[model samples]
Target: MSSHLLSRPLLLRHLPSLSFPLSNHRFRPRRLSSSAAVRPPATPEPAVSVAISADERYGKKQIISVTPQIYEYILSNVREPPILRELREETSSLRGSQMQVSPDQAQLLAMLVQILGARRCIEVGVYTGYSSLAVALVLPDSGILVACERDARCLEIAKKYYERAGVSHKVDVKHCLAVDALNSLIQKGEAGSYDYAFIDAEKRMYHEYFELLLKLVRIGGVIVVDNVLWHGNVSDPLVSDPRTISIRNFNKKLFEDKRINISMVPIGDGMTICRKVLQY
Candidate 1:
């Protein structure tokens, strides 16, 4: 008999007649001495609760935070031409400078134009012409970019850059409300003629611009909508601002719309690339 079994007289009395061999470690009861230390049960770590609380406070994670170093690295790698760099730097000091697209976004737009072999393009909001210039630079010599902007001062700056870049012949500036300009084009039997369109105008009239542009761009043509995320405000339920609500509703409308195939890219505020798949 083991010493553990011998120490417990009450346990020994209830034992069956069949003896357990001393060498049978499986049946042996561990000796519990007075000096033996007892371990307390582990408490749950606080990290799990902290993470849950954070998720609740901030909503689900939607995008990776682009730090300054990362943005610098991205800019360093992009092939920003001299005239474009000058235009961007000059626009930085102007009011509403934030309206201009970032260098990386300009690169993406230029690449898209090249990929589409886009000859006829339309820009709804040409704020100082960074994006327009980028697209025009990639276009063939015969390509044309129709730019719409109501602000004369901004248009003048854009024209200066276009002239400097020697792409002035390729750009046709429309000094009128974008809707009026688009309507005029449709009136002239120019519907379904454009290869590409970019919308970055008034937030309230996005749907109008979209509807008008849908008629302007040809089948299989692409329309790139900027500020779709509205600085990550579209996903936040707490943000009930007019612009945010408008963008949220617009995003939902685009998702449910069957006429076009869409992809919402998370680059620079956010851009929704919609390719018209059905004419109806």
Candidate 2:
């Protein structure tokens, strides 16, 4: 464990931060030929509102709300692989489909996997396998993913999609509690073997999961915790729901911990990226 976990510097040398820049050219609509009949606009366009709400402006930075038009624009720009599209559509019809990660989040996860050069990963909650598929699709042929999901039905759906995506062999589905599975891995001397671990399981167990994952992952490995915002409930003072409270406290603990560096990006609910920087 010491030798494996202490290889942080060597791993860090292989990984670098990545960025993508958008095209600078402004979009322009093309005019139809005079020979073609001009079509009338079907709906009257609403005036663009300049007024921004308090929630729209966080501190000095302003962020646009995900309006229908904005969502359409985003969907039009991001390319979704056919297998991912099919799996997403199928998951949309299932009960509690909202639990599945958004396409943008899926894309981000894939990029993270590639940037990290990750081969071994762990998904704490595999809800129909959208995220699992996303990460697995980007991993190398010899890569492996340990997917933990207690729901057998959900695991079945995930397996079917994984097979269709041609990444079935890369994933090992574990139908058991996430804590149990993570602990079992540690007990079997698999600590510091995983390159990444994603936590989207029971909210109350997030802290517990983090503790276990911190010990299991190497110093350079990353652990991404989803829904850290708890649907905008974490920061609300009046909202005292158990889950919300749990997430709020967990976020505080994560912020104070020195073992990992954190960036709580406001994407798809909220994703807290914790990169291990110190050995346990």
For candidate 2, write residues 1-280 as lDDT tens digits: 1334222211111001111122332222234568764564598433222335466355444434443334435544555677776777687778788788876778889898999999999999998998999999999999999999999999999999999889999999999999999999999999998899999999999999999999889889999999988767787899998999999999999999999999997767789999999997
RMSD of each predicted structure: 23.8, 12.0
Candidate 1 lDDT over residue span 33-120, tens digit each? 5676444339732211111234767776554344432444444566777787678778878888878887778889999999999999
Error of 1 at 3 (Å): 68
Instruction: Output the number of the lDDT-best candidate.
Output: 1
lDDT of 2: 0.79
